[model samples]
Target chain A: MIQWAADVSMLVIGVSLLLSLWRVLIGPSVPDRMAALDAATANVIAGIVVFAIRDDTLDYIDSALVIALLSFVGTVAVAKFLAKGVIIERDSD
Target chain B: MSEILTSLLILTGAFFLLVGTLGLLRFPDVYNRLHSVGKASTLGVVSTLLASVVYFWAQQSTLSVKQLAIVVFLYMSSPVGTHMMARAAHLIGIPLAKETQRDDLKKRRGSVPANE
Candidate 1:
């Protein structure tokens, strides 16, 4: 059945998410950890799609978009901080 | 006609998502894994959204377009975000893998030695 297959696949995605969480926890450096977070977001996106399909609702899609956007901003801000030690600093010369 | 197309699109999208998950689990390096998840999963999610847009188009045209718009924004943003993060990581002096060679930035900056 299609439902069964999608469910199994969702489980696989969840497993991958656990792996990403592992990296987020054990990553030796900041970028590594942030990369893991990004991966987690991607997994969440997939999970959202799967949930939408299963529940037959479009609302989940909206949440997915929100998560995707927030994760983008969060990951970029964190990465910038790691790289330059500051996200943004206004001129005060 | 629409069912078949939607079915194919969803299948392909699922396949790509599966591959992205595999890459996330299997890849050793952070940057490499990002490449795996970023490119592969972006394509997968976008394709799936497009499929949903198509499916809902048959049922109710307006809603799917909203989903498509979300997909468009996501597609545009994901890559730029990933690349920025990767380059940021490099700039922050996160060491590359041991097998990596010929880092021109390192050479230009005189950070890495000549033999390396």
Candidate 2:
């Protein structure tokens, strides 16, 4: 049952990743691309988790956590740059 | 029994993840897309992680702390990231969909200079 579920979920997640890729390819605006990318990141993490289930190992969870942290930072940095044109602004106060 | 529950959770999570991506593909604007991605994907990922926790606990007779940590971290971070991206998009004047009824931020911020 776990094997079957993992297979199905991995397939579903792969399709999702493809869909998000399509959105990224033709997204009309910057945030549209960013949103797609964010969704893709989530999909990737889901894939990794499902992989862990399939392999019956705890190894992938750490990598998923790392991906999550890195993607969050990247999203924030890009969003800040898009909004204010700088990731780390000099004192604005 | 535990396998049944884990499988159910995995299917549920996958369904949600697919829905979130479909929304991202079909939504007419950035804000709408962000709305879809933020809520649905987070739920999807968390559900999948929970499934892992269940599977490990049932199989190994030990809790999966890392999976639980990921779940908690996701809950905290997904929204903040989404909000930051939405605010950035708005500030930079990513145009709203034609069907948008109102923009309260515009009223409050008093005419952001269009940068996009």
Candidate 3:
């Protein structure tokens, strides 16, 4: 029963991932693409958690953690660049 | 019993994720898209993580600290990231959709300079 549930949930998440990918591909503006990318990363993390649960393993949670951290950093960097035209500002002025 | 609960959580999480992605695809503008993706996906991811936490605890009779950490991190970061993205869009002058109703930020900020 749990296995069947896992399978169904995975299918649903797979569809969600694909839809986010479609947005990424066709998004007209930079921030639109960024939002799609962010959603995709979240979807992937959820997928990893589900996979770990289905496999009855705890190790994959670490990978999810790493991905979450990296994606947050990447999103912030890109956002800073978009806002300020530079990722690392040298001076307040 | 626990399996049913876990499954329900997982299914609901998946539904929220689907809705978020659909919004990302269908929303007209970046800000609106951000609004949809940010809230829905965060809830979805958190729900899924909770399901996993429950499953692990049921199987092993102990909680997984790492899963909880991931949930905490996600809850903290996703909103910040979305806000940053929205601010960036505003700073970069991404125009609102044609159907937008108001420009409260513009009114509050005393109008953007003609050059910007």
lDDT values, one for every candidate: 0.73, 0.93, 0.89
Clashing pairs in 1: none
Best by DockQ: 3
**Candidate 2 structure quality by residue, lDDT tens digits, A1-93:** 889999999999999999999999999988999999999999999999999989998999999999999989999999999998988877775
Candidate of highest TM-score: 2
TM-score per prediction, in order, is 0.84, 0.96, 0.94
lDDT of 3 by residue, A1-92 (tens): 77887888899999999999999999988999999999999899989988988899888888999999999999999999888788987666
TM value for model 3:
0.94
Q: 2 or 3: which has the higher lDDT?
A: 2
Q: lDDT of candidate 1?
A: 0.73
Candidate 1, RMSD to the unseen true structure? 3.9
Residue lDDT tens for model 1, A1-93: 335545665676677688778878887777777777887787788778766765666878888888888988998798777766778855793
Q: List the residue pairs that clash in candidate 3.
A: none
How many residue-pair clashes does candidate 2 contain? 0
The alpha-carbon RMSD values of the candidates against the true structure, listed in the order shown, are 3.9, 2.1, 1.9
Please give the ranking of all candidate structures by lDDT, highest first, separated by commas: 2, 3, 1
**Model 3, range B45-84, lDDT digits (tens) per residue?**
9999999988988999888888889888988998899999
